[model samples]
Target: MYVALFESSHGAVLQPLDESGLATGEARDVGASGLAAAVAELEAGHPRWVWDDTSRWYPRLLAEGVRIERCVDLRLSHAILRNSALTASSTLARSAASSWDRAAPETVELTADAALFDFDGPAQLNSAEDTLAEFALQRAAIAGAADPARLGLLLAAESAGALVAAEILYAGLPWREDVHDAILARHLGPRPAPGVRPAKLQAVLERLREALDAPTLNPDSPPELLKALARAGLIVRSTRSWELKKLTHPSIEPLLEYKKLARLLSANGWHWLDTNVRHGRFHPEYVPGGVVTGRWASKGGGGALQLPKQIRSAVVADPGWKLVVADASQLEPRILAALSGDRGMAEAGAAGDLYAGIVASGAVATRDQAKVAMLGAMYGATTGESGRLMPALTRAYPRAIGLVETAARAGEKGEIVSTRLGRSSPPPGPVWRTSQSEAYGEGATDADVSRARGQARSWGRFTRNFVVQGSAAEWALCWMATLRGTLDELGDGAWLTDSPHLVFFMHDEVVVHCPADAAASVEAAVRESAAQAGRLLFGAAPVTFPLTVAVVDDYGQAK
Candidate 1:
């Protein structure tokens, strides 16, 4: 059963729908403050809530102490169905663009005491009638899809992801500001006054200037620093750390050190601490389906995705809790194995480290060679050691290597490729199309042909990775969704906000904050979720998705 909730002019309205998504009753108004109670009552029937945006509606509901088992997030569902190649023949997929296609509304972080619903901000799904119509279209689109079951699973996983994102935000990650400050003080000296550089950074700057024999050099100015390096007879193209590392100079070490510290200060320094973290929690605004590959992105917080290893100590669990950190091991390569049905590669994945398995298969003598060769296969690498090792890898794992090669060749011909579940790569831009046309058309120069080939290979790299990355993202969504349900069931008598729950998710990693007593159960759940996700996608294929699960008191200790 589905219960659609929509914001109305007077208040909130709920309309019941049968399993087939047909309306069974007229809309009934539930006044603004009455939403929680209304939803609480509806919860007895275990109906899936259909709403415009999960980020907008679910957060407020969670704040009101209301948690629903399932939801059909219309905004997220529309995005997936509209762009999915599997749904191309559906009316909703071909429908003219509307406000629904717009990116989900920016999430507003609300304090617990703030108003539950802010109607005056902007009208979104303000009419039960419009919300119902959108839901119907989405259902019809799924029904008419080429592989409706697969697309339906994708949509369900995607919508569940939105709910998880909102809940993660509300729950917030456990953070220890004291630990963060101490880590900063140890590396950067004491926090300086506002607008002033830290003592350690200033000291490193001095050392850099002295070693380069340019007393007045401003390390922050790229052009000035580049000029100083040239003046010091270090003729490098750029000051990127990789290039700097190749050169042996007294200043190189300090310059690299200075850059590293600067990044930490600028990205997660004192100002970041004061602004983002509060009440022992770091509430990063998670944007679900933000990345084109379907990975989640974050906004309005310290580099959530790019948190530095040095500061990871700050991610301490609450006193009575444990952080259940688990990351899928070699996720993408394993995904490629399952996607291509490469029995050899799948067997490799089923064993421990896929690269080690490749070595054992005699594809390469060294693990590193196997690593680069597999990476080259997935990423379109065709140079030096990677290229040299590729043939062996291909000979050993023909199905896996051939799958990506076919994708690369298709991309080189300017054809779009779709992911396993049917997210198609966008066509090349007009400039690229024109360049290819000019290269092969009436008259062409060698330079024109060369440039076009280069462009094609570049695009090929993108498309080759897109399929594996996107499908891995789908697997991750299923993993998280399955784990979420498992955790909910484990903590049946307790509210999600007050019980063991997910607090953070990176691409292949997830951190669950749970009571110490439930730590073992959570670890089991994480491992079980990975197995379930693999089965959900590949259907008993030999490929195995293994997770490195760590139950620790601090996030840094997990690894």
Candidate 2:
């Protein structure tokens, strides 16, 4: 019987069954216990169904020849899957909390005609744990503080700040918990000494409110309220009695405590701070082609490869170690140049910064203005300030503008676009078609349709961008492949993948977590990869993409 489990859009386990294993073949009146009973008998025990035929449809999809190979064992899958569960559905989390005071046993057993392999093996478990640990450590190093206490606090603050930011930035959008967790985990490395406590921070805020004569407040006010008060200059007094700044005060204590808790959570299956082998060396994970537009990802460390300039304080190298960072400036624009075969855009990139060139070419008033202009032209952003400013940019960068505009039109018409390397976009289905028609329908007074059209336009813009971005991703993949091969030739002693391991990815950048000795070679590998990416994408284009290089002891400086 083809027992299957499928995940709903909401990620709930859905098990759809006919009397037998087939989804559309035959129907038999049978209870859930029939298959359960049979499987139980076959396994000779009550096999804990982690997920079964009634739970998910993706597994059963294999029967229809939807090819998918397992990347890790069941145990590793369980871990990743469990991680997903922690934030799966907010409602579900609450429900799970109420349903089980203790952890529930989750198990799965399956007998397939193809192959039966043990997923929860020792090597896989160890490897996964190590990966997680390394990721955690790399983040800690990037955050600045060397000691565990400070690191914990930094992590907590960053997480809290990000949670607040996400709520503010995308108020109505559905949030993915994994995205939240990853964002929270990104910059949690280290902090300066004498971290504040979360509770104390609260008390300080209360006192500040009392001082301001605004004591009559809702008890359920968000922590961001206090932050706002602080920003507004109403909460002026520092909680610290000494010369230490506001960050080191008793009021910030709760934030610190939260950090300590986060540290504990992060330190799962690993050693504690003082005695841990990570002594002063700050190594960050590098993920190439992580972003939708061929950027990079940092595994655990904050985006050390692309950290903001002022925050480079965290990554202090060991005695012999140095950070060597390289970034492709105006990458997206350059990719646009190649994709569109735009001489103007290519010349702009060749001259230097695309934005600067736009300004110099009299395309826009300033570099910042050029951004809004170009973005507006490509995506058909004909509203707000962008609409007012984009015409000149389009006139100046005609080829590039034409490329994205064409793509946008194609997307609006429900057409597919492809990356250079066969990564064709799937056509918009009935929903998209209906939405577009609704958006462009005659005699339509409602702006919802227009708004939807704009969205469709943006998707076209995205698809257009994706062709360049996805192709760039292919290039990055090739670079990584080449780098890995090259490192293999250098032997384990001279070079290693463990340090500059590929961990995280986003669009337009790369981060490499590396040992001291491997830094230079890794730098070379990075450059070579960029060159390789160029070769892979353009074959023989006149414009060569150059990565502006920087070497820093800390990740914060790289940005």
Candidate 3:
């Protein structure tokens, strides 16, 4: 059953629908303040809720201590179907932008203090009728898809990801402020006041100034520092660590140290802790499907996706709880193994270390070489040592390499390539098409041809990686959804933080915060869900997606 939620005069209208989103029963009306109780009661039926935006509606229930099992986020689902190659012929895909395709809210926080659902005139689909109509359209699109099962699974996984993102946001990661402060102080002396640098950073700056012989040099100023480096006869293009490392000047060490420390101070320093971490939790707002490849992205605050290793130790578990961190091992490579039906590649990953298995299989002389060659194949590398090792990799894993090579060729020809689940690459832009056209036109300049070729190769590389990365993302989502459902079942009727819930999710890594007693069960669920996700994506496929599971007291010890 699908229960659609919409804005009513002073509350919400819940219309229960069948699998295809057609009304099957009488609707229920609930007020703004009582919405949480209404949803909690409805949980008995286990109906998948349908809402315009999960970010807009679910937070209130979470805030009220209510949790729903499943949901269909219209906005996210619309984005997928609209661009999906499988649903190209459907009305929803062909139609222009509508309210169902609205962007993510500026602030994802929608408390119970306001109306149950935010309304924006008739332009947005906030009314009950409009919401139901949109749901019907989405169902029609999925039903008419070339591969309905695959597209439906994609939508389900995507929506589940939305729910997971919101839940994780509410159940913020446990943070240790004192530990963070200690880490900062150890690396960067005492925390500096206001705009001043820390003592250690100041010392490094002094060394840099002394080495460059620029008495007033500001290491923070890239242009000024580059000028000083040039004056010291070290001509470099930029202040990037890699470029600076090429020149072994006495200033190089201090300059790199300054850059590292300054980055830490700026990105995740004391101010960041004060702003993002609240009440001993780092509440990050995650935007699911934020990246074009369907990967998640953190909003302005939190810096959740880019949590620096310098402060990872601060991600501590509560006293009675433990952090269960598990990252799928070599996820993309394993995804490629399944997507291509390459038995050799699948066999290489069967041992849990794909690169090592490849070396053992005589694909490459060393594990490092196998890794570099496999990466080169997936990323369309045609030069350097990685490129040189590609022939051996291709010979060993023909189907796997061939799959990416075909995707790269399609991309070079300005055609679309899709992942196993149906999320297709966007078409070449008008400018790119024009460049390709001009390069082949009469009297085309050599420079134009060269530029067009370079652009084609660049796009080819992106498509080559996209199929694997995007499919890997789908696999990760399925894993999370499966893990979430199993954990929910194991919760024995508890909600949110009271149960084993996901606290953090990176691209391929997921961290669950659970009671010490449930840690072992959660670890088992994590491994079980990984196996299930592979089967869901590639039924009976031999690819083994192994995970490195860690039950640790802090995130720093997870790896």
Best by lDDT: 3
- Per residue, candidate 3 scores C-alpha lDDT tens digits across 1-559 of 7888988887888888998888998988887987889888888898899999888898988898888889998888887888889999999989887776645222212111111112221225467877788889999999899999999999999999999999999999999999999999999999878989899999999998999999899888889988999899999888899888888778888899999999999999889988988899998788887766677867766677778888999999999989999999999899999999999999988977999999999978998898888888887778998988988888998999999999998878878778889988666667777888999999999999998998787778777887898899899999999999998977888877888989898889999999999999999999999999999999999989999999999999986
TM-score of each: 0.94, 0.50, 0.94
| Model 3: residue 179 alpha-carbon error in angstroms | 0.8
> Which stretches in model 3 have alpha-carbon errors above 4 Å?
102-125
- In model 1, which runs have C-alpha deviations exceeding 4 angstroms? 103-126
Error of 2 at 549 (Å): 1.7
* lDDT per residue (tens digit) for residues 1-559 in model 1: 8999988776788889976678899777897989989999999888899988888788888998988888998877877787777887888888898768754322211110111111122225536667888889988888778888887788788889988888888898999999999999999999899888899999999999999999999888989999999988999888789999999999999999999999899889998999989899997677777765577777776656667788888999998999999999999999999999999998876777999999888889999998899888888889999999988998999998888988878877777776766666555666777888899877798999998888878777767877888899999999999999999988976998568899989889999999999999989999999999999998979999999999999989986
Which stretches of model 2 miss by more than 4 angstroms?
A: 1-312, 316-319, 378-380, 437-455, 489-506, 513-521
lDDT comparing candidate 1 with the true structure: 0.84
- Model 3 scores a TM of 0.94
- Higher-scoring candidate on lDDT, 1 or 3: 3
Models, CA RMSD each: 5.7, 18.4, 5.5
TM-score-superior candidate, 2 or 3: 3
User: Please, what are the lDDT tens digits per residue for candidate 2 over residues 91-200?
Assistant: 32223221112122121111111011112112211232232332332333323322333223222222222221221121111112332233333433222234432333
lDDT of 2: 0.44
